[model samples]
Target: MQEKDKLNILRHSRHDWMNVVQVIKGNLQLDRKDRVYDILNEVTRRAEHEAKLSDLNTPDLAYKLITFNWQWQKFHLDIEMIGKPIDCARHEMCWLKFFDQFFEKLTEQSDSMTDPNLLVSFHLQETPYIEFDFQGGIQDMKNMQEWLAEWKVSSSCYVENIVANEQELVFVLNKK
Candidate 1:
């Protein structure tokens, strides 16, 4: 996405979240306790979602992961992040593309499932270089690998795929 488009989406997201907060405040002032409480819960959910998409001073990869987490949360899917932190590299944009597709498909599949116990998580490997971890559904693993291969053929960075268990998938990458 273009920088302008991303900024616009984020701006709109902030506005939408604030609207929810205003609803809660207004309902509380009216002494509608039940409505206030209901609105407050919704606001909390939206605020959490916004936080994930909030601008980070780090690289685009970090932003992608954070936004992906938020997207999953908005869909009512549980998301977890592991590891410390890492800086972004030059070839980070490809990673963001992979993450966008990853999260999009995850939400899509999760929404279709009848089971409420399903959860999706993005695990990050703490490294100074370009490396991270991932764990989640089996289908997600396959889709990510495929995207990585396509990215590698046209990109400069190399991404290594690791094993994925029932709970997560693991991978590493180098920023060119």
Candidate 2:
């Protein structure tokens, strides 16, 4: 990543922190101590998650995740990531591109829903593969499958799409 990009990310992160602080201050002024405490706990949990992501040493991935959390407003994303950082330099760009397309599709589908939830969990295994579990509502399953098939052909990674139910989909991207 370029120095300018790093600086921009830092600025954005700082601005987000300031906004969180402002919210806490507003709650305090309103004498909503419970709300303030809740906000603090949430912020702390998010900060810990961010720290773990940073430990992965993949700045691009970390930045994209942070930016996604800040930019996406329609759906709440709950990410649970475990395992040590796997060197994924070769697949970073491909993963990022896939995420962009996936999020775009998700946003289009979730626009009508009230408070949609997206749960993403990643576990980096000793077998040198990261298992990504995505559970959410999809508007069009056929379209998404077609897109993923196209992505599979373009990338060297093995893409597995498992349909758990009508509203839930799980994908596992294995390193080829």
Candidate 3:
């Protein structure tokens, strides 16, 4: 990683830590010890998840996730990873690009919704896969279909499945 990228990651990490501290402080000020404890536990859990991701030893993937969290402010994104992290250095950039484009399109499609929440999870197995659960509204199903078709043709990744409805859009991509 370049020094500049390292600095950017550090800056974002610091900002996140500041927010966590502020939340704790606010709860303390309000005499909400239970809430504070809950927040602490959640933060601890997230830290453990981060540690697990970091163990993958793929800086590009880590950087993409960190930068995504820092840059995208429109919706709440929750990421859950199961199983061990597989070394994906060979295709990390491709996967990162795919994720960026997918998230951008998801945000655009769901912009008019009142509450937009996205759940992205990855499972590492014999055939690793990533799933995106977007709880919002898809404005144009035709457009999404076309985009997915084009993406499928252009990328080496395989679309395991896609389920769309009035409430949410879910898709799974498997490494090919």
In Å, residue 51's CA in model 1 sits off its true spot by 13
Candidate 3 has an lDDT of 0.76
| Local accuracy by lDDT, each model | 0.51, 0.69, 0.76
TM-score of each: 0.40, 0.69, 0.84
Q: Give per-residue CA lDDT, model 1, range 99-137, as digits (tens).
A: 566556555443234332323333334332333443334
Tens-place lDDT digits, model 2, residues 1-176: 79998998789889888999999999999999999999999888777777776666567877777577666466776665677666556667666776777778777665346456676655655544444444556677677777767756664666675554555667776656
Q: Please give the range of 10 consecutive residues that has the lowest summed lDDT in model 3.
A: 151-160
The best candidate by TM-score is: 3
Task: Rank candidates, lDDT, best first.
Answer: 3, 2, 1
What would you estimate as the lDDT of candidate 2?
A: 0.69
Q: How many residue pairs clash in each candidate?
A: 4, 0, 0
Global CA lDDT of candidate 1, please? 0.51
Relative to the unseen true structure, what is the C-alpha lDDT of residue 88 in candidate 3, on a scale of 0 to 100? 62
